[model samples]
Target: MSRQELPGLPTEATMLRDFPWVVVRMRCHFCRRGGDARLAVLAAKHGPYVTMGRLVVEFMKECAWAPWNPTRRPQKYGMKCGGYCMDLRRPDPPDLPPGMQGLQLIEGGLSEKLPAAPAEFERRKRVGSDD
Candidate 1:
């Protein structure tokens, strides 16, 4: 079946809340192309009322994993070629939109589900801010 045909293939947290193993694809909000443009999904746990939380999706890329060079944002370098690289945050807090209500997702789609952001990178974000 095609990616989208997988029901929750390009699964949303909401979809995963119902179905476990699902395959889906997500398009890049920055890229305005079609086809494999959507190469990610947001998988979540299934439930009745509606389980809310961050959805963890899976992604597969054909690039050499690089260790944060402490000076690269990955995206800045063309050498860093790969799949999803951002978290799918909610558009609005409190509650999701009508369509988003049934679909648990925010941004980045499945590609958003990474092992974890580099600690150093996070540290930089709070360089001057108070904890």
Candidate 2:
């Protein structure tokens, strides 16, 4: 399904600490490999701030069908891993009020513009040494 259809699904920026479940249950249909990971243990190993998307990638690394698995046989038309989290299929939560939706408010708000890069540094092409 397209990402737009899965509006309730967590985005790449969704941190591990923000996940709804205490334990993450992941299964790979291709390898028949599955496991339950405690949120606390995962947070300790990967940090609470690590994104769910990143964890998904890490979790699928060992699967033979995983596209990014370097040790897997090089096949031009191999099936991709069907690894996924079980908790992700939970019913979507009720929508928040309009005012409560969107980006979280920062303490000081964001800067109007980014700081300009140094022109001298941009022009330099030397591999080493200040000169």
Q: Highest lDDT, which number?
A: 2
Which digits, one per residue and each the tens of the lDDT, describe model 2 over residues 1-131? 87634645655557888776677778898888998888899999999999877887888887778887777776888788988776664544333477666677766534665559745655666898777
Whole-structure CA lDDT of model 2: 0.75
Candidate 1 per-residue lDDT, tens place, 66-102, comes to: 2244454556544532344232332332233577657
TM-score of 2: 0.57
TM-score of candidate 1 versus the correct structure, residues matched by position: 0.20
**What TM-score goes with each of the models?**
0.20, 0.57
Worst 10 residues of 1 by lDDT: 32-41
Give per-model CA RMSD. 20.7, 17.2
Clashes of 1: 13
Residue 102 of model 1 has an lDDT of 73
